[model samples]
Target: MPRVIGIDIPDKKRLEIALTYIYGIGRSVSNDIIARLKLNPGMRAHELTQDDIAKINTLLQNEYVVEGDLRRQVQNNIKRLVSIHAYRGSRHRAGLPVRGQRTRTNSRTRKGKRRTIANKKK
Candidate 1:
């Protein structure tokens, strides 16, 4: 695994995909980073050279947050949402679908095992 901006990116994944593991770096940001650093999008993480690491590190530190800072930012956002009592926040509170997906027919994973209705007695 190659370490980028103090975070280890998995060896086998593409640069964009691997960067997503570090938090805050998604597809668009990864593309921008690669473009700015002149890095190959298809390059495997572990194949990166020392110079590549330096360039990527510089880019991340200069313009983007990763790892611990990114995590804290996300937590703070969630906390703020919860404090505001938004629908998504309520979904987070209830651990159910936030997007108004049909809870009656779907959301088995969130809703857990369904109750079985007993057959009517003859």
Candidate 2:
């Protein structure tokens, strides 16, 4: 495993694919990074030289928000929404679907497991 920006990327995977193991980077971003660094997209991660890794680290730190920073930024955004009492924040607070999905039937993913109620005796 090669460590990129404190995240360990699989050495067996292609450079482009391995880059996606980092938190904020997806396929397109990985491609962009590879292009900017003039690295071969098809090259395995383990093939990277120390200089290449240094270049990647410099580019990421200079231009991109990733890993811990990205996570913290996202959490801050959610916290802001909750502080403002937004509807989405309320849904998040309640652990329900944030989007306007019909909760009457579906949305078990957000709503979690069902708790059945017992019948009242006479």
Candidate 3:
């Protein structure tokens, strides 16, 4: 494993793919970083030299909001929505889907286990 910004990326993978192991960095962003840093995307993560790792670490710290910072920022955004009583916030608070998915039947994954209602016979 090769450590990048405190995340241990799989050494067997290509550098571009391995970079995506870090939170907030996806395929496109990893490719962009590799391109900008003039790194070989085909190179394995374990093959990187100390200086190369240092450069990557510096670049990520300076130019990106990642890991804990990104997580906190997302949480803050949700909190803001909740404070303002937004519709989406209410759905989040209720543990329902926030993307207008109908809850009549298909939302069990989000709404949790079913509660049966018994009917009285006449």
lDDT of 1 by residue, 1-122 (tens): 89887777898998878888777878999888888888899988888899988888887888877778878998898788889998788787787987888887989989777776674334
Candidate 2 lDDT, 1-122, residue by residue in tens = 77888888999999999999999999999999999989999999999998999899999998999999999999999999999999999989988888888899989998777776663333
Worst 10 residues of 1 by lDDT: 113-122
lDDT: the better of candidates 1 and 3: 3
lDDT of model 1 at residue 41? 92
The residue ranges of model 3 lying beyond 4 angstroms of the native Cα positions read 113-122
Q: Mind giving the per-residue lDDT tens digits that candidate 3 earns over 1-122?
A: 77889999999999999999999999999999999999999999999998999999999999999999999999999998899999999888989999999988799989888875663323
- The TM-scores, one per candidate, come to 0.74, 0.91, 0.88
lDDT of residue 53 for candidate 1? 86
Regarding lDDT, does 1 or 2 come out ahead? 2
Q: TM-score winner among the candidates?
A: 2
Candidate 2 TM-score, C-alpha based: 0.91
Clash pairs, candidate 1, are: none
- The candidates, ranked best first by lDDT, are 3, 2, 1
